[model samples]
Target: MEQLAEKSKKREFVKHPGLGETGIFHTKADGDPLPDSQLLTFALAGNQNCGKTTLFNQLTGSNQRVGNFPGVTVDRKDGVIKGHANTLVTDLPGIYSMSPYSNEELVTRQFLLQDKPKGIINIVDATNIERNLYLTIQLMELNIPMVLALNMMDEVRENGGSIHINEMENRLGIPVVPIAASKNEGIQELVDHAIHVAKNQERPGRMDFCDPDHDNGAVHRCLHAIIHLIEDHAKRAQIPLRFAASKVAEGDEEILKALNLNQNELELLGHIIQQMEDERGLDHGAAIADMRFKFIKEICDATVVKPKESKEYARSVAIDNVLTGKYTAIPAFVGIMSLVFWLTFGVIGTWLADGLDLGITWLSELVDLGLTAYGINPVVHSLIIDGIFAGVGSVLSFLPIIVTLFFFLSILEDSGYMARVAFVMDKLLRKIGLSGRSIVPMLIGFGCSVPGVMASRTLPSERDRKMTILLTPFMSCSAKLPIYALFTAAFFPRYGALVMIGLYFTGIVTGVVFALLLKGTMFKGEPVPFVMELPNYRMPGFKNVWQLLWDKAKDFITRAFTVIFVATIIIWFLQYFDPRLNAVSDSQDSLLALVSGIIAPIFVPLGFGDWRISTALITGFMAKESVVSTLTVLLGGSTASLSTMFTPFSAIVFLVFTLLYTPCVAAIASVRRELGGKWAVGVAVMQCVIAWVVALFVNLLGIMMGWV
Candidate 1:
């Protein structure tokens, strides 16, 4: 027992790279201590879709984990580089600038200013160096030790562009490493240089963009003057003077407050900023932007060469003409999504699920027979065979469907088609009061709602963030796939693909209506203009696709054994016992039925009113996958048995109710964490009310059409 406790303690102490630990080797296996200076921490930062994440994944492989920033919902991905023992790498949320314009930007900037990682790896997209370098210039001003990781170098080369690496390194006054992160090319060299910079505490030598003496040097002069004024404050606050000066020149209110300057100092700074704007014939923001772009242009001219257009660029342009065209893009997107659903539900996933179901059924029967032969206690036999096996087996059987959906979704994301989907949908979404950026979180919600809700942090506006979080749950996550598969297989087996697609679209349409209502009422505001990059499409790597599929499968399996497994036991116990804990032959006499009976009538208007159905929905609040498990245990784990509880129309209505109801507890917790408890509780109660109304309408409409 002591040894077991020691082993458990050891397991708990295994360093989690994703949480930004250097390593689990402060003390050797033999207990000799190591120096703290040997440990190094580096931050990886870049714009969205710049291959920063891919590089992080390559560096860390399976050693990373996702965590939240201190007070924000943005994800902080941390990992330990393989073969680099004393190094910890933190992957910051992707942001275009270090300015606190959005939560993501604030999170990234706060980490750099406060936590002060040993070094920075500013990943720049080689194909779009001009825009990417804008953020790089900001990082350089932070005065941190940094390396330029020019990712997607292969794409740049293939597009007939070339970068003079030596010239770039000399010009930036930092090491330049060209890497195609997706292909795992030049990654080791990049890491080596980054570690060298961190260990030596090497800061960038050149921070000035436009020289103060240049012809159009108003912005530069103002920046330098502000740096001198705020030098003491910046030093006291442990912020880089150059960064603080730039923000001050840009008239950032947050920087002004943080500096806590006196009224006289504030008036003097305002006068200087206004004078600079007058001299530059632009606003402070524009003046700063113009200077940055001017510097970027100069750097590109010196180090970057663009050759004739390549075949891949031409192909992508030709494809985008239709894929993002005004008339065809929506139809193409819908058709593509429909095909994804068909492949998942009607063909590959369904076939695989059938085999798994049979295996689970056979295993259950074998367990039952073995227990009977051994004369196991009847109650124990029921608990093992009927409770655990029936419940967990039902959820596990839908693993293929979840994996298949995620596989295709990951392919779309990797191929760059998903970005185009956002672009195409931006116009329609605007009418419904959301920008295309909202779609990123909604699409992610299809995989899981927790990250989906957290992804809303990327929105620049609080209203958009809250609204996106509210609508995210309507996307029907993969966890709900088991419930859909179960019902479709039982009731609409012949048209399974069409039915599944309809359910997804129903969720989407429901979200759109609610978004319109919210936009017109409580959250009255126009969506900010949508701006996003469309990366060149490439064939997704098989390894990357497999990795994503494996992640989805692992998460699904883990939940089945943990949350769902425990919930099943509790539910089974409740269904098998009375209030006094005495075994009850009939479930109607059990505590679960009596408790669920109160709420069962609320769903009566939606066609499913049985205590068993109500119990499933209650357990579903714990985890959506539990809905299928609860039904399997209560209905004897057979489609035929489930069929006796509802007609075809009523089954469809029940599926609708499940689709539109409040998300599971984990997602609600995420919502609370991101948007506060009031919003979280409001979302839960609102979803329940909406689901009831929508299901009631569907049931009434179906009955009027004589479909039931």
Candidate 2:
């Protein structure tokens, strides 16, 4: 330690590089050029629920994170292959086709074209090869060096199906490696094949999908004509000629815009396409689709052994009869979610939190004793026992409640039940001007509104995305659970589960009402057509579920220590000292109390006019978790003390207010990112106004009914 400190003592300031003086840094020996800044990356592209993420995790080990839904990988994540430090693999959002109907397709397609990755790793579910390979065909058209990871091959074999690997490889003109990503089977060979193919710069060799004999040579003639005409344009735009031609044939506007064809060239292209459509007896788009499907059919006929429907699939169908049948699905969804809340708040999570709270109380007493015995400074001693422990410790006990709630949510998601929820809710959601896809972001909102807002990107239409973004914060995120858990435990212990479920129901009901209001006002158009494929129900992967749970728990604990910890210190200092920075005899005389008192009148109609609760609500703009911790500090060190502050009626009103209010600063910033500054500000102000009005009405109704 002394030697390290002595060495640091010899350090001196260096000149800034911006001043044309080189800073103290390593310089290249000789005239060797600097290495390329871009890492060698392989795009991991695949359909939803085809084990693309699992393969990414296996390849990257601890370097990946996962979101809940299959089709909702709203962000692009990249990681280094475990053994290949010089190479990177990007896990793009799960996409079915390169068409621009949705965000995933646009993102994956744009990343492939624009980012210029070295290669592509396309994962296809071997059990569903025919459908999966439709995407495979589209990806091949990108003309990038590509390898196909045929995932879930073990399942294919178990279900009595097989593939002629060599024949498939020959037909597709790319390396095909069968991998069971879930089982870690065939991973290393897959890695070697991927690395080799990427290193070789080997693009797909087959571009001729046109069957000149079958289409009367009409479609083939059109594609060839378009390719030759726009060959220079494709080269200028840096688009693969084959890919650009096919997109032009399909009337892809984005590609057409990028190619920037002149009026004369456009007229010639349209004439060619019209002639092909007339000869092929289909529209231009349909004719192009027919051509590709014909090619896909030939490949399947030659290389795939169709599986007899597996028992797992049969089971999924039988379960769907009950869970997804028209009459049963909604009731089933309601019952299941209610049961989850009950288990989390009424039983498992509650028991765990009680035990943890007891432990924290004991530790706090021990620390209190030691500090008093040491003759610590009185104000400092109070801060230790009351500020840190009472504030942070109280909120920490509710960690299990958040984890437990997400545990069941993660199960629903991983088991493919959530997709069914979107399907069942589609008919109802459309009436409110949102699509079935909007339900996903809202469901994800229960965990945290930031990801929920991000998840809105997966929606197909701008109107749906904006409306969903505005309503996601009304879902009562898990961060707000600490507030509900603390309040219900203090005031409604016997019916705590009922209160918890009621709160969730209230958030949903509120969002629905807001969605309706939005439909009639800012957004009047119908939701974009909802199209989703429900993956066959299967047992949730234990590792996938556990990893999600671990991530959620770790994130909550981290916030408690960092964001909440700092907020506690600032809050304690504010509530301890007066305007002049002198110690106050009573908390009501402190700076926070004086400032919050002025704002307390705003909540007078909602029945919570106390400066302390108002102050916690203000700090809640920082993080919802700060509410419980702040209340714990301001009221007293004990839950029992908290119970004395609010009457039952007022407590219920407070819960309603918190349930419907705007989310924390992080979530608002996410809204800003997804929408814009105006929408973010509008959502914040609108939600607060709604919360106050609803809370006021509840208080008024209670007083009229003599319940207050």
What shift in Å separates residue 201 of candidate 2 from its native position after superposition? 0.5
For candidate 1, the lDDT comes to 0.82
1-708: candidate 2 lDDT, tens digit per residue: 223212212322221132111111111122233244535689999998788888999999853445435446789988899988889999999988888878898998889999989889999988887788888888877777777889988988988888888677666667778889988997887777666556655566565677779868898888888888887898899998778988999999999999999999999999999999899899999998888889989998998898899988999999999999989999999899999989999999999999999999999999999999999998899788889999999989998898888899888888889989989999999888887888998888888999889989888788988999998899989899999999898889999889988888888888899889889999999889887788888788888889889988998999999899888888899999999999988999999999999999999888889999898999899999999899988876766776566899999999999988878999999999988899889889998999999899889999999999
The local distance difference test score of each candidate is 0.82, 0.84
Question: What TM-score does structure 1 among the candidates reach?
Answer: 0.90
lDDT of 1 by residue, 1-708 (tens): 223212312321122132111111111122222354577899999887777777788888853321111111257878888998788998888788878877788989888988889889999888878989999999988877788888888877876789988677666767788889878988887777777667756667567776666546788678766876787887787777777888888878887788988898888898889989899899999889889998889889999997667666678799999889888898889888899999999999999999999999999999999999999998898888878999999999999999988888878876778889888888888998888888888888888999889888888888888889999999999999999999899889889999998999999999999999999998897888777777766787777788788888999999999999999898889999999999999989999998999989988888888999999999999999999999888876665798778998999999999999999999999999998999899989999999999999999999899998
Models, CA RMSD each:
9.3, 11.4
As a TM-score, model 2 comes out at 0.93
Lowest-sum lDDT 10-residue window in model 1: 19-28
What clash pairs does model 1 have? 18-65, 18-78
